[model samples]
Target: MSDKFPDQARVVIIGGGAIGCATAYHLAKHGCKDVIIVERNKLTSGSTWHAAGAYAQFRTDPNAGRMMAYGGELYAQLEAETGQATGWNQTGGMRVACTPERRREYERAITIARSFGVEMALISPQEAGEIVPIMTTD
Candidate 1:
């Protein structure tokens, strides 16, 4: 939103959310000289504000995992590179297997994450309880 309206742009992106901003940055990085992002409000003021900023390393699809990894990388460096805080926190995530079926799903996710060089462990319920004391193993 540098200008209300840019006269010219090699790429015109709608919305100034995280996704749109990231898209604009990459397009410019890859040699798109002029990139313009139009936003109804300030950048990240939309759903980005409400975003939990969760970075899931696991994805059933390898391509999706890569995309998520790239975003995580960007968030990790956004503050350092541009001197602007992206409000990104690297808080860890957990997938609670509340039932046998959910445990199977976690197992699949673990395999997929590991296959793409992402680290994910399939821990026992007891181990999980050790990390989260309030967790109910029943």
Candidate 2:
């Protein structure tokens, strides 16, 4: 290995997961050229590899939902910018309820999503199964 390191950098990131990479990308986008990302493993080899990649942003807290939504949008744009696929899918999502209390929870989540214009829907068990074919009503 070469015993040499870059002479200078404005920012040094310690991970190569999605968050770290995204931060690096944003920093670079804002004209911060001296950014270095140090990874113990290859890019996306950490927790990001195991991520379910779900983009559901149904939250009672509007700011939290907005942040998640922004992350999703940034992920979508990242692929195009880097010429690498981030495996983003917009198939939509559903939260099922197996009991009355759980149903109320789903209702509240749907309301929150709607308030943020997040484009979600409340559906029956059958509809949920249709969206996620592997799901079981039981």
Candidate 3:
């Protein structure tokens, strides 16, 4: 960290949030030098600092789902690639549908996810209960 800011930079990014920092990282990774990030305050001191470390990969749009999948894959390998410990655990999650309409929506989502190679399935209430024994299916 340098107290003196550069007089000139080829690229100047506003904000120091996740997206901004990610953009800067990718730009530098692709050999973009003289990139400067202008933050209002310290990095990630805004909403990003209080963000819940959770992400949903299932999406109705195939392209969005694929992008989400790519982010998941990137997070899984981030620690190894950057030598920085990112506590990302890939524990498979479940979506509980309380109504027939929700179930149908889940089914449609499953189809879309499968089409883009995202593993998803709609399980029966009994099956779901078995997976989480403490959960009351009724």
TM-score of 2: 0.78
TM-score-best of 1 and 2: 1
Q: In model 2, which regions exceed 4 Å deviation?
A: 1-4, 129-138
Model 2 lDDT tens row, 100-130? 9988887777787677677777787787778
- State residue 115's C-alpha deviation in candidate 2, in Å: 2.7
- Superior by lDDT: candidate 1 or candidate 3: 3
Please give, for residues 87-132, the per-residue lDDT of candidate 1 as tens digits.
7787767787778897888788778777766778888879988999
Candidate order by lDDT, decreasing, is 3, 1, 2
- TM-score leaderboard ranking: 3, 1, 2
Q: lDDT value for candidate 1?
A: 0.80
lDDT per model vs. reference = 0.80, 0.78, 0.87
For lDDT, candidate 1 versus 2, the one ahead is: 1
> Model 3, 77-123: lDDT tens per residue?
88999999988988878999898898888899999888877789888
Best by lDDT: 3
Question: What's the true lDDT of residue 100 in model 2?
Answer: 95
Q: How accurate is candidate 2 locally (lDDT)?
A: 0.78
